[model samples]
Target chain A: MSDHLPSTARKPGLTSSAPSVVAAELDPPTPRKRKAPGPRHEDKRVAILRTAAQLFADNGYEATSLDKIADQLGMHKATLYHYVSNKESILYQCLVLSFGNLDAVMSEMEDRSVPPLQRLRQFAHSLALAQNNVFGRCLVLVGSRPLDMMPGGEIRQFQRRLDETVRALIVEGIADGSIKPCHPGLVSSMLFGSLNWVPRWYQEGGKLSIEQVVDSFMDVLTSGIAAPRR
Target chain B: MSDHLPSTARKPGLTSSAPSVVAAELDPPTPRKRKAPGPRHEDKRVAILRTAAQLFADNGYEATSLDKIADQLGMHKATLYHYVSNKESILYQCLVLSFGNLDAVMSEMEDRSVPPLQRLRQFAHSLALAQNNVFGRCLVLVGSRPLDMMPGGEIRQFQRRLDETVRALIVEGIADGSIKPCHPGLVSSMLFGSLNWVPRWYQEGGKLSIEQVVDSFMDVLTSGIAAPRR
Candidate 1:
């Protein structure tokens, strides 16, 4: 992944090949130079994570290897280890990274103070976008199998928290009289299951856009599949 | 699987030690006795399939092997092969068996001449039952991967046919004014995804019965999640 970084930000091995004068001009000896490594390292870490995610999605989590990820990034296996301690670490970080983004989106949605029904629609759209995105697709395709093997149960906890938030949204909708009164837990499961499975059949340039799919799902959820009572 | 067979059906190697009188009585020297191989062979085949399905569910299809299955059955690998051609064949058969049973149930539901809404409710219950069953759990866990490797396109074709039937039900419901107008393809995907994911969380003797889950799902599907308009 670092291999694709701008020549200036790439490892010294490649950057050193540039004319010495041009390199010297780009980096002036200053205290602020210390801040450069932080963002540069973070960017490289994300790049490795994104690449690993794509590989995990393409060839399942078990079948994928650290060597394959490094090969895909055009980096040495040693350099790959610098970003991630091991394959499981990569899997762990990939899941956390995707969930972090999704949690952030949900947090923003919560802050909107919209009606519960409208919140549900926004939540559905965000879920569709996140799952269909390259990173989240890996999370859904691999499911929670990686978390089962990993230590500390953080992933499971994080997932449970997400499920609870979804249930809470539904409960709120029911209270506000915007959503029908139903078993919040069951309805949440149906919503998540449907959203999670979107990546299974959704094509990038497919006939239906992600928004269209979300609209269709949300419509079905809000409006009974049965005709309105006469 | 053969190890659990009744004494009368036990392989000759194990049953030979029976008292001569009992053995003679069981065999009953007769011309028509030669025809017994038909039902006996079919029973052994079913035993092998049931055992294979259990193993496949416990351990994934790829991790399971012919040797392990034969060992589980307390039979020689050669004897196992006599019942099944190979491991893939066992997997292929396991999928076909489960899907075949579910397909039969759906067909029965279709023939009831009930309203589309009622038929959908019946379909939901049958789907939940089938997925929670031992055989159906194997199908959900292993997923359609085995079908991809299996020689014929029969499994995929069978699956497509099922999907079409589901969509047909929704379409019929819409035409008959029992179901709301919606995208049959998208709604069917949502319905199947929710139903299929049931095995992931449902425990047979858990707090909720399969009937409860089915009823909850059907309620949400038929009635809109939002409150009825005043």
Candidate 2:
């Protein structure tokens, strides 16, 4: 997660090692032998998602078609359907992967041993770094707007959980006396706004490294820009 | 700006009293005495833009069409073209107006009479308020992705200018000893990320008013979320 890979190498997947629900769902059941999807099958699904995410990020989701993704992947459109149902499904999977990554960050935030402010900093750092990846870029840039008519409220639920995680961290910080008394909801929005906006302007080979960017954000978040009074 | 009206009343336009460049450019060259566009023409043009902006914000720029905008405005598609050449033109005009609003904030920030920190707060306040409007929602939500094929680089220029304005404010704040030492470029990005993300989650009549939102943002931005040192 620390190393921001180039476009081709940026195969964003669920942070956990287990096969994702997307991977499981994409694989059709065979009556003869109901076997777990092999590593190769999982790899292909991830690759399809990666390519689609890059295309979606480069071209608007509405503009990027399944045919384009297949062309990018050097696969037939039929073969592309073998991996995902449609463009929206690919987008849904990308978001699933993205929210999974955030869930991992939330787990870190839940570590009571660490100070709440420190955990919040870690959350910001991890989130900004995550945005450097293609899937994260898709989540931020392409967004869930294209998935408006898609069935299932999983995305909305994930979004609500993400918001709650940030708000919870702020509430904990306030209770622990590490953070100032502030509206958790408003502060959470500010934190997300700053972190989520990273992908819009952050470049791979830009002058400032992702670490530097995250550090600057942390400084602004913790100490703020106001000069110390005499 | 303080009054964030409902969708119908949210007719976002150029902040300046003078007729916008978009309005002038939209008008065709007449062979007869070339008089300035009348108030009725400007009103109709603004109405078209406002209606189109709402559609673009609601349905997205890609999904929206001239026909849909026309249907929304109760005008024929050909009549819609009378005011704007194409959907891209309408999008470009919306962006033009949104940036024009930001340019107004930039002008306010340029007032050296106010403290740099105060000016920075004003920038955040004005910017968040601007996001409550339909055009601002178009800029932040739909974005300039669909207009990638559109010829003019005006949007890019406006974006660059917006970045510079924010950076200049941070630099000024630092120079005046009002702001702590920091990377102006990175800080500007953080500031913009926070403000721009407002349109995504801000509701018209949500629990928090735009004023409360802006105020909370200013608080987090000025005073670090961290509790005071012993």
Query: What is the TM-score of candidate 1?
Result: 0.76
- Write candidate 2's Cα lDDT for A41-121 as tens digits: 788888889888888888878778998999998999998887677777788777766654566787777889997767777
Candidate 1 lDDT over B1-230, as tens digits, reads 22222233222211222122222323333554454435566667767888888888877776688889989999999888666767666665565556534555556656637877777778778677767766678877777664554444555666676678778888887776667678899988888888887887787788888899878887877774223435
- By DockQ, the best candidate is 2
* Candidate 2's TM-score: 0.85
Among all candidates shown, the one with the greatest TM-score: 2
lDDT of 2 by residue, B103-153 (tens): 667777788999776777787777777677877788888887767765555
In candidate 1, what are the lDDT values of residues A14-93, reduced to their tens digit? 11211222223223345544544354656677788888899898777867899999999999999987767777666765
Please give, as one word, the docking class of candidate 1.
acceptable
lDDT: worst 10-residue window of model 2 chain A: A1-10
